[model samples]
Target: MYRWEQRGNLWCLNPSRPLGIVEMIGGGYLAARPQISYRFLLEELAAAGLVIRAWSYVPSLDHQGQAIAAWHSFQHEAKRSGPLNYQISRRPIRLGHSLGCKLHLLAPDYGRDCSALLAVSFNNFSINRSIPMWNILTARLGLRTEFNPSPLETLRLIKEKYVNPHNLVVRFNNDKFDQSYRLLETLQNRPNDRSQILVQQGSHLTPTSLGINDYGHNSWASDYLQRQQIGNFTKKLINWWEQNAC
Candidate 1:
């Protein structure tokens, strides 16, 4: 069974099992917004027999302070409501999308307890200087680019602390976000015990772009919805937990 509860500004989804995962959504503007990814994740995880709890906090352009506070709150609430098996502590894992990934990568270190991280459609990359004025204007007006923080700082922090040299998985879409190659280069330097970089065909909003219909070779929409893929990912994450935890 699945239950949804409201906790202040956060939405908590409790599954029958104690073990659960948290996913943060991304809103381009400073105002908090909802994305289709959260719903898709919930349905997919539920089908896979895994408990999934999610929260969407107020979005902020102030990437320094409020963002950090929101993440801290997310961590606290997730821990309090999620499965408390002593075994799962050393196996902490996070899945974040877009700006959420950027914020998570900057999260303060919690010692060796923090184990694994998976980033999807992450948008932490330097701005291309060669873009035309019209394109820049359109990006600023259409996508609300001004609200986005410097990807350089986020990338630096991820390189220094976020990407655990022990376990990390990076999933990207080649069609969207041309800077993925550069992002991969930064992640490859880290000494992850097991690191995987998968390039699926799609765009930045692949989770919502392809929908749930066609499971094509150049698409991740199907993979995202696959129970077996979820199981496999969970198993890989659990293996990391077993090896790292005492």
Candidate 2:
């Protein structure tokens, strides 16, 4: 009864009668195949009566450019005359995981692209921190390797240019790579800010596990736990938005 429809690099889950739409972006590497990497979480949201629009891409060094590209993709689709065109009256909620969180924040919309944003395991790290021995290897190879804005620049940009205040930052207890606290501080310092954080039991990779079936050869205690956490996270997400009704 549930199937993911793909068009180019964008994948969608159109419920029979969608109550709202979720525009999601997954973390690096895994984002290249979001339909499969994020199958479990996306399916849960879809089954809960929400349409899903997940963009697929491999993270590139140019974070800002990628962000712009993603926004345009969604915007262009919405302007088209079809089911993909969300109603003008209701805005969709944007979701991002890890590096995808940075991409969403860097989007050139001033945060007006969605009703609100849900960032899970927000990760903003320098090229050296993100990729082990990156600087050393680059220096030795005489190569120029770095994130376009760099980590510090990213934070500065968010503090100065990001305008939308409605945000929910979720940091799994075990996600050491998450920089939610830092992001929260920046958002809170902004005018008319309304940002919140939720800590739960999970990991950085927890948001990407397929959990395709109860047990499908990849089954293990950790896998089961991941599934449970996925379910838990989904419930919290639905509950939070419904109570706030954004």
Candidate 3:
């Protein structure tokens, strides 16, 4: 059974285990879709012996409120679970994907007490503006749009306040190679050189697609897990986090 609850404007998923970290899901419209995505990611993490608490928020409204909710969940879990015996001490890490990364980056004031941040597929200002013309046209027609907040403002805030000496931002480069490269360039210009950048083979959307369980098919989870690229990427991400965030 899932330990689900609505905390203020955020939907919280607290797995029935001592929380080791908190992951905030990025929803483009409503909480349900991202919650489903996060559930898959959490299952993968749980298989690797990491307990995750997740938050899903409504996209159009409650941006600030959702950020605060994520912060509170981390704080509450840290207080409850105490320190970890892992590499980077027992502090809880904040993991964000896509637009979720932007939200976390912009809300530095909220998660000031978090141990570190894992930003998956983060894009910088110019790179965000440089989205594919096709994508822009589709979005204009309300066809293909992801749940991204004010990406430029978010990056500016992160550069100004969040990316600093103590906390680290590890950006995973997947499909959006251009955005990832631009993000690295922007980080290089920042004062904090402690941030890390990694370019992986997959794209920004691949991770979510890889983790999906097609219930309509028989034994879908097992079949999905058997794919070569999925298995390799999953293992690599898990190992990388264990080595770095632990």
Candidate 4:
């Protein structure tokens, strides 16, 4: 059994005796309700002796702003009480998926607070690539739209600012939108960086626990496959993290 609680926008999942913390940020729209969106993964981590704190937020054009807000919010919660304070005695492991990976990389503290980051399906697609119709509509209206830092600028910033480099960039074998290569390349260029990439056997949403939507709940076959995928991926992630922490 997992102890699940919601502290404002943060979702906390805890075990009776936690070995560590896995602070997470889910992908764009899915993040709006992280408790539901990441339930399976977070619970699995908790079962492996971890405390989880997942920050929930809506996607916005100002990704940088959202990044700062998420970082500060996690920091604030850690200072308050109970399992969240794990960051004080033992640094928490940061986990991010899809667009969530970019937000963690751009956090205000530059990843100094976390022990390391586990980026699953790192995605930094250009505005047009991410939202094809948006650019066309904006161009017709004589306006331009772009992420606050833009895709290229984000990589440039990572090369310059991001501090903690002990990262595991997980890329799927079939995720066409995955940008782990670019992200890992920038990170490895950093001085003393210890970043590695792991190619898994799934797609972009493999890290997510889908419900009725996205055709994930139509049949038992899908359920079995998803559970197997999530289980394998979770074991690989935690094993790598524990080995490195030692």
Candidate 5:
């Protein structure tokens, strides 16, 4: 059994016995209701002895600002919640999916907040790719909403600001939207970096269970094979988090 609570933008979960804390951020809009879509993944982590604090947000034009806000929420909530023993021994491991990965990388104090980062299906798409064609056209014709740190700017900022040593980036085979390789390369730019990328046998949405409109709702996502694949990924993540927490 587990307990769930909401304190502003975070969803806090406490299991019967927790091994560590996971500060989780889901991709873009998915972050708004991560509990509903990531039910299986959240449960699996809890079962493996993780107390989770899932941050929820809808991205605005202010990329850096959003990242900073999320980071602050993690710190304040971790200090306020969690068992005293767990708090003293371990910093929450940062877990992110897709755009959430980008946010974590851009977080102002990312290096100091968590022990390591576990990025699943990391993505940073161009404005044209992320928004509808109509919106793109509108933006060009005067209706302007800046994508603050554009994809290129995001990479540049991460290269300059993020300096965490331990990082595990996961990429799904069929995730066309994923740019984990680019992220891994950026992380490797620093000397003696211990970042590693793991390729799994699933799509971009494999880490996500909500199942989007049509492409994500296919039998492939719900089949036994896919379930086993995701389960394996979750197990590996839990093992890595436990083994690496100092």
Candidate 6:
């Protein structure tokens, strides 16, 4: 039986025998929906004895501040929900995809919140790349505003504020929008940083299911390969969490 509950504004899924906890934040607009790729990932994790708490957020100019507030809120609610709701005796793992990765990394106390963070397809695109060409042009012309803590600003903040060293950054083979390498470099700049990157097979959207479009190639073999790739990635993540997030 699936046990669903609401803790604060986030939704929780309890497995029959949860071994640990995962707090998920999805990328881009998909973050607004509960049915993103993490939904599938969470299902697999549940079968392996894990519970999940997931939520969505609307990105704003003050994304950094918003990220901090959201992280704190998630923690506060998780604690209030009591230990049984999540296996709180064991620290929860942080999982984020695309823009969600940035939000988690930008939190001022990022290192202290979770046991470890798994960031997939970490994206920090410039304003122009994030929006339509016309919108970019308009923003460039001062006719429209752009997201604050821009890509550069976000990187700078990560260098200055983020202290956590245990991070797993994944980038798909053909994900044109991925900026994981950049984030990895910034993280490795810290003398004690243990951040690492994994290159997986598939595209930028391979790790996520946006629910609006088909992912991978339009072939049976392609679909099979993609599924296999995601399965492998999840296995690695679970193993890492068990070894490190605990």
Residue 130 displacement (Å), model 3: 11
Find the candidate with the highest TM-score and give its number: 4
- Candidate 3 per-residue C-alpha lDDT over 1-246 given as tens digits, one digit per residue, 9 for 90 to 100: 455555443445544444355555553442345545555555565555555656556544334455666666655654554444242344556666755665665563644555566666654333224445756787678874432335565555555666533333334333443355554555566774545665565455544543433232336555455344445654666555556553
lDDT of 5 by residue, 45-164 (tens): 877778788899997767788888999998788667645445446777889999889888888885766889999999898766787684768767887554778888888877777878
By TM-score, the better pick of 1 and 6 is 6
- In model 1, how large is the Cα lDDT of residue 100? 58
Q: Compared to the true structure, candidate 3 yields what TM-score? A: 0.64
Candidate 2 pairs with clashing backbones: none
Per-candidate TM-scores read 0.65, 0.90, 0.64, 0.93, 0.88, 0.85
lDDT of each: 0.51, 0.83, 0.52, 0.85, 0.79, 0.75
Taking the tens digit of each residue's C-alpha lDDT, what string does model 1 give over 55-172?
Answer: 4566554555555675676667756755454534334455556655566566655213344555556665433432336457867777644334466665666566654654344454
For model 2, what is the error of residue 238's alpha carbon versus the real structure, in angstroms, after optimal superposition? 1.9
lDDT per residue as tens, model 2, 1-246: 688888666898888877778888999899988888998788889988888889999888999999999988777666652654444345788899998899899999868767788899999988888998888999999998779888889999999999888898999887779999999998899998888898987677777876533233365775776667688789898887766534
> On residues 35-137, what C-alpha lDDT tens digit does candidate 6 reach at each position?
4445556666666787777766776667787687768867787667675654556777888889888888877676676788899899888766787685757
Please report the TM-score between candidate 2 and the true structure.
0.90
What TM-score does structure 6 among the candidates reach? 0.85
Highest lDDT, which number?
Answer: 4
TM-score winner between candidates 3 and 6: 6
Regions of candidate 5 where Cα sits further than 4 Å from its true position? 82-88, 143-145, 211-227
lDDT of 4 by residue, 111-197 (tens): 888888999999998788888898889989999889989999999999999999689999988888899999999999999998988
Q: After superposition, how far is residue 213 of candidate 4 from its true place, in Å?
A: 11
Total backbone clashes of model 2?
A: 0
Worst window of 10 by summed lDDT in candidate 3: 209-218
